[model samples]
Target chain A: MPEKTVTDERLLELLASEFTFEQGFALLVSAYKQRLYWHIRRIVITHEDADDALQNTFVKVYKGIAHFEGKSKLFTWMYRIATNEALSLVQQRSKHAAGTLDGNNSAALLKADPWFEGNETQLLLLNAIAGLPEKQRLVFNLRYYDEMPYEEISELLGTSVGALKASFHHAAKKIEQSIRAI
Target chain B: MSKNTGQELEELSPLLRQMREKGDGLEVPHDYFDDFDKNLKQRLTERGVRRHALRQIPVAVKRRIWPGLLVIAASLALVLGAVRHFNTGNEPAELAVLELSADDITAYITENAADFEPEQLAVLEETPDAGNQSPAPEAGKATPEKEEIPVEAVEEIIDEMTDEELAELF
Candidate 1:
């Protein structure tokens, strides 16, 4: 999946001093839409919600670009934002489903649904991941689904490498527990 | 602990190999990545379009650059105005009083005389019509009613104060 679009040269040039928020914004959306959407989907578990959250994330990035300090990588920043969006969605769902259901219960609910057409391993993985706590769930998705390194995840989440390693360790244990249960 | 230190563990390899398999329960259609790529690129393009739309917003009213510039300009203007006002406060008429004292005034008057009466001397600075340059008044009849230094008084002072004396005084 080695895909490179506008080089930093053209990207910067297209985004040079003349960049009206228009071209730069368009280029950014073109570059990141799908990656962000899938990242959101992996966490949030609904295509429609993922779509909405993705659009909202892009809009947020578009509006906030002026404040972008460029100290971190753009993708890392974007991944952070997308991660936030997904977590926020989950938080909202948590609020709605609060005492009635926790993440594991909700995962069970979604898992039990007959309409789920996903492959068995994916369902198993999702079920196992769903059984994990929210932070651990996000860590697992980033490490496993998005195939992101702890270093990048650390940068995005502003956590220390040691803490992330611990988190990933705990998450892997939980997911393995779920898989073994399956 | 599932946190295997070495890649020697068979778990990760089996899982990855399993994920690659069609029946392993993660069978994304062949088009999944393609769709993901397309969707992502589309999102990125949408973002680009949004940025383009945002750029279309006129920059004249932008707060980041223009407002800051306006504030700087206003600050400079205020500073300039203050400097000018303080400079005007130090103008000649207002400043002249600072240079005057009773001794300087008496010295200016004692060295010369052109028959100015005591009344005229009393009203020397009040001579409203004496120093009228538009028309010459009678030599001694002109009242000291305006800001006028009489020509005869000037002449007498010039005569009494020789060029050397003037130089020495200066």
Candidate 2:
């Protein structure tokens, strides 16, 4: 027999009710965990960090679900939280590596990470992407990799669509330059 | 594709275009998401238990506890007040000596000379008004005679007292 799939609206309604919150959250986690994990993994560049950020994102969603006004799609709100957690982890890693030999090379860390499975070309691409500034890298990843629309990206990031377009353009140019130099 | 992105991609070099097409090269272990979901559910359950514990204080328990809590709090406040009162009562002389400057002591003694023991009044009488100004004699009041100590001499006496001597006096 085919199991009934719950809609996001139904899930939100259940989550808002005290009796069904646990069941609603479990369903929510199962539905979105993979998408959210991949999104976080791309930003943080490590599976473990992504795992931590994913869990943190869900925990935040669970806690904040009651206050959710449903102004935006539930997934979009979760993606925003996941993005913040991933970026916060990256910022922490940058600060931790500031004085070390690693310096600001997130690509080097990604290469050394056992979970990273990129080939030489992919590594070069990653290295190029890593060299872009943080916002540009995010813009590029969301647009190019996730294939998210600029309007959606703008909503998640609170940046103007025009600004995101410019950022993605600059990010692509910089990645091209970096890849050519390599 | 958006008009802007289509134009941007058209302008990109073939290698750059291929890179963008190739996507971010990342992978996860087999059954990683399954394991992650299980662990997350476990954590959420734990969190739910904790949150439930915090908010599930029973109405009956709260009703019974409030008056007891209020009593404990009031008792604590009274104990604290009594301790403060006792401390202030026990340290009156020390606080008076430490807080009042020599001139203030002389003025206070002169104003209320009838209230003190003769020995306490004599201590004020011997310690000169270090400022060299005498309190004015009121028309109906008897002026306690002011003994003037040179300002330099008063400063020297204060400077000569060790911390131990000052503490002992207090």
Candidate 3:
């Protein structure tokens, strides 16, 4: 089912005014920071990278809140921002590393990462999932890991539901085949 | 996560279902979230101070400049009005003209003929015995040109001066 609308009118009103802006913004960050952090962490695949992206996202949200027209849920709008920031960080890092965020590199990083609690099997699955193409990888993670609904993913990614489903399906099949070969 | 039931995941792919059963391996440090808002608050406060400082600059500049600008504008208006008031009537020029004897006027016209219109020359020609050159009887000794006018030309020219024209001369 689609997520219920989460726009709080009082929060928006407080954000719109200069006097109550910080209070509203604090509440906003408290509510969404954990979710945003995990989502960015999934894309950027590092605690540090995710933290950077999350902070930048909140700064942007703070600056842009007055202009928000409430056409989409606040969570969806923020998710889109977080997604872009995380993807941008990935692209930047890939450029520096000569596009070496492949399955082997991701697996190595995951193994070294102290925050990652997964064993060998989980690491192998994550490596296979990371090996998928960028769009498929994002679709797969958001659907498989985050369990975001198709409707909400459609809103966040601006992709048709059918296209997202196809991407996710292909991604899952590829990961399965990669893991089976291993 | 609530929407994805065990049966649902199994239908999608058994491998994904197995992976789903094992939680995603990511974790944060203990009590990481406890300090997140506090750290973010510090960063935001710094940023907010910077933004507030930026927003104050133009307003401060306007405040500092406006009073001086208004004074300059008023000074310019006053100077322009004084110039206009002084220039409105050529009082000094009219007074100099009135004080001249008719003979001086005729002589000045003759000497600076290129400066006057032909109509002024015609008016000069109509002066009775304008050719006559005699000083006024009551006037003290005048310049050589003043000697050229008879007393009648001086009286006639004086009589032609309207009251408003005389007032303007004063």
Candidate 1 chain B: 10-residue stretch with minimal lDDT: B52-61
lDDT (tens digit, per residue) of candidate 3 on A32-99? 88888888887777787788898888888877775566667778888889989988988888898787
CA lDDT, candidate 1, residue A152: 78
Which lDDT tens digits does candidate 3 get at residues B65-160? 578789999999999999999887755544445466665565555776675567656765777663453434556754454334555555554455
CA deviation > 4 Å runs, candidate 2: A1-6, A99-104, B1-8, B11-13, B45-170
Error of 2 at B117 (Å): 99
For residue A122, what is the lDDT in candidate 1?
Answer: 64
Candidate 2: which pairs clash?
none
Q: How well is candidate 2 docked (DockQ)?
A: 0.12
Fnat for each predicted structure, in order: 0.07, 0.33, 0.31
- Evaluated with TM-score, which candidate comes out highest? 3
lDDT of 1 by residue, B1-170 (tens): 22333331135445533543332132233555456535645666665743422222223223334666789999999999999999874553323423444345345556543444565465544533333543666688864343444544444434544555444444
- In model 3, residue pairs whose N, Cα or C atoms come closer than 3 Å (at least 3 residues apart or on different chains), thus clashing, are B133-B148
Candidate 2 local lDDT, A70-119, one digit each (tens): 56677788898998998888778768877321214766777778887777
The sequence of per-residue lDDT tens digits that candidate 1 reaches over residues A1-182 is 22347543334334434544456655666676767766787676666557667777876776565555555766777788887888788778778777422446656555654434666666676666666776777776666656676777788878877887778767776666667676
Whole-model lDDT per candidate = 0.58, 0.70, 0.72
Judge candidate 1 against the unseen true structure and give its global Cα lDDT, from 0 to 1. 0.58
Best model per lDDT: 3
Candidate 3 chain B has its poorest 10 consecutive residues by lDDT at: B49-58
